[model samples]
Target: MQTNQTYDLLTQVQRIASGDESAFASLFYQFGPRLHSYLTGITKSETAEEELVQNTFIRLAASFPVDRNSKSFRLDLPGGQQ
Candidate 1:
């Protein structure tokens, strides 16, 4: 059974896939900071972290309308394996 938060995220992803800019903004504001922190820890550079996070969202914007048959959504990193 999905929890409220999971359902909410799925709704947001669906909105984002439909080109809902406000939903994009909402998800960004909701997850960006924590994503940044995690990236910063791994890369150890603020510049890289910022770039990475931006690239992430860019990929997200283009790669949505997700595949329902897939058990999970994939976010490919720069020059990284798909």
Candidate 2:
């Protein structure tokens, strides 16, 4: 049985795959603190961790295929199909 956190994460993944920014934001908000803690524990550099977090999110956003048919969404991402 999946817990609420797991279930929510799964739902957010599905939404994000369909280019849901809200879902992605939810996922970021949910994971950022945990990721920060883990990164800090390993690297012990807050600046590096912060930069990595932003870069990681930017790369991740670029990687996902945008759903332009999603109610005239903003963000003119290239390399995606309808």
Each prediction's TM-score versus the true structure = 0.72, 0.68
Residue 70 error, candidate 1, Å: 24
Question: Alpha-carbon error at 75 in model 2, in Å?
Answer: 7.3
lDDT of 2 by residue, 1-82 (tens): 4699788777877788787767777666767778778899888898888767666666776777767776533432222211
| Clashing residue pairs for model 1 | none
* Residue-wise C-alpha lDDT for candidate 1, range 1-82, written one tens digit per residue: 3699999999998876765667777887788888998987699998888788878877776777755654444344333334
Every model: Cα RMSD to truth: 7.8, 6.5
What's the lDDT for candidate 1? 0.73
lDDT of each: 0.73, 0.67
